[model samples]
Target: VRLAMGARDLENNTVEVARRDTLTKETLSLDNIENTVADLLDDIQKNIFRKALNYRQEHTITVDTYEEFKEKLEEGGFILAHWDGTPETEERIKAETKATIRCIPLAGDTTPGVCMVTGKPSVQRVLFARAY
Candidate 1:
């Protein structure tokens, strides 16, 4: 409190006050378990995040053609491939390979190229996967 208020002497120590909002019902007794529960929740979130990161890193794949995409899909991973930027082409690839466009990254290779499935023009690659 003294440091926060820029006081240098103990006798002239400045006071500080703070407030925290709590969501527990008025009748529910916390009994000091709130900290324990918060710690457990933090640990659980960290574990889940690490598991997802590892899974994505282990399963990610990149392919340049429809044939390669099919082969990679059989192996089961996140596929990065050029898309023609049309729903029809996206649906056709999904119908043929059971892989769907999971996400289109905001940042990726911007060079124009032929689509992996339809040979149509595309501006960037998209992420494909067999979502669970």
Candidate 2:
């Protein structure tokens, strides 16, 4: 059976450790391994997905003005804001705020507007976040 690899568990897993907790003689039963893997998969599909989706929803923000964008950017999380779609404006925003446009959603707000930084016309909003 295939195991589901959840985001939370994968994010928490660390390969480097101070010491080995398990002894050489220690072993796991096939049933235990299968059950653990199965449980993890279920958690990934149900719990992790929901948690991540919620996190994104909670963190996402929309701004029509540069002032609003700057204020929200300081607090962290993703910002869905209109960009003038110019390299100069994008670079200036990133240089000032340490945030970069992460992606343009396939189904984002299609409403035309002005860029937050340059006040130039923008076709759509783009996702922006601080570099990790």
Candidate 3:
């Protein structure tokens, strides 16, 4: 997600074609290997999500009620849930479900309510992650 012609100024050691992550002691090279690795992983993750969503689009059935939503959540994969972005509720949700805030999605609802798990107030919706 970053671009550069020469990143030697920001990087640690540059041995002609390699850079090192000073703190972690990891060595990496630029303009090719690192970029290629990142590109490959990004593509793979995107493809995986696309395939999963396509499968859901083709095979998964939709339901009409909150009860149905909850049932689907119990089975889990991806579920769109309403959330208010309070840190306590976020933490509580993660604690109870072993899921954490993943992404904010686009924009989330601003409605306020106590967290279903912790009874603490919350303010915005974000992904609650418990990945398989």
Candidate 4:
């Protein structure tokens, strides 16, 4: 969020408030400016967070096979797939698809499964993404 006050506007007792997230601007009176700015800032924070969470949820994908993993990799975003928990398998996936394990998420779907690539037992799904 940004606040701009021009000398001309100072004479008129008004200022401009610009929201970075939405790229919107409004002219507000000097009276209660502090409270107005504070409220706008809080609202902006919440809006940005909601937008990011929605984007992540929409982009995240789950795959059960190596073919599906490779197919999804081309489309981009986070891929949740079983891994054998071995460095060699990790290296092979990265080498093949240019996607690396972003993390072993601590939350959500903890059920065990077989690795998509190696056909070995996997403790859980790991996040994979190609660095931007």
Candidate 5:
């Protein structure tokens, strides 16, 4: 704080309180960074779970399967559909059909289903939304 205050010429401001934040520079490789990112993604998954719970509480509807979900796509919100994690379907869906995916799930047995667009078998449940 003292060094930053001096550098910023904040000595003239008496009412401006300052505090210092210290951080350590650990020796880390790209692998370490990748692991850290993975850890962060784990936390984000938890956060998303909470959000999903809230979403369910707020707007719960029943669609038994991917086929059923696809049949009801004319009306829109966030639609969860199985995908191959490709931009082609998502992008094409957005371009031709005007749907945007909000997100993909973190982990699940989300059963393989056909892509909402190409009718190809999907690997994961990719979210879908209608964009403005």
Candidate 6:
């Protein structure tokens, strides 16, 4: 989230802008206010997207075994693991690790594999996570 506040002094024809993202304040002439704010908004959007992408890349993990999955779950992030398309297996994993399937991602690697927990045939890896 980004916040910008402007304190305008009409008598002096000056606008002081405080930016939340950079934690900086700058005084600008009235003529530059619109252009400056527009630029800052664009920078804020790119900054937010970059941070989120970095975080996901850092936290997301792919595990091939239940032991690895449970170990990673303790650290708390998204898990990509094979799931044998079965409710019973899904329920067991949740009951055991308190983690549930967040999604069967439609993108990325769709290679078939054996279930991490059941050893049954799995169509693809699925995303798993625990509520934060």
Give the TM-scores of the predictions, in the order they appear: 0.68, 0.68, 0.39, 0.89, 0.45, 0.79
Q: Where does candidate 6 stray beyond 4 Å?
A: 1-8
Among these predictions, the greatest TM-score belongs to 4
Candidate 5 lDDT at 85 equals: 64
Per-residue error for 23 in candidate 3, Å, reads 40
Candidate with more favorable, higher TM-score: 2 or 6: 6
**Models ranked on lDDT:** 4, 6, 2, 1, 5, 3
Model 1 lDDT, residue 113, Cα: 83
Candidate 3 lDDT tens digits, 77-130? 555455545676556666656656557656545455544454445454344446
Superposed model 1: Cα runs more than 4 Å off: 1-31, 107-112
* Candidate 6 lDDT over residue span 1-132, tens digit each: 233334436666776777776677776666777787898888888987898889977989999999999999999989999999999999999999999998888998999999999999999999999998
- Using lDDT, give the best candidate's number: 4
For every candidate structure, what is the RMSD over all alpha carbons to the true structure, in angstroms?
A: 12.3, 9.9, 11.4, 1.6, 11.1, 2.7
Higher-scoring candidate on lDDT, 1 or 4 = 4
| Residue pairs in clash, model 5 | none
Instruction: Name the regions of candidate 5 deviating beyond 4 angstroms.
Output: 1-52, 56-71
What is the lDDT of every predicted structure here?
0.71, 0.75, 0.51, 0.95, 0.55, 0.87
Give the alpha carbon lDDT tens digit for every residue of 1-132 in model 5: 221223233344322222222222222233345565466556656777888889754542334354566555665556666665677766766676666766666765578776655667777676666666
How far residue 94's Cα lies from its native spot in candidate 2, in Å, is 0.7
Clashing pairs in 2: none
Candidate 4 residues 93-116, lDDT tens each?
A: 999989999999999998899999
> Which lDDT tens digits does candidate 2 get at residues 1-116?
23334455356542221112221222223445656556655655676578788999999999888899999988999999999888888899989998999998889579988888
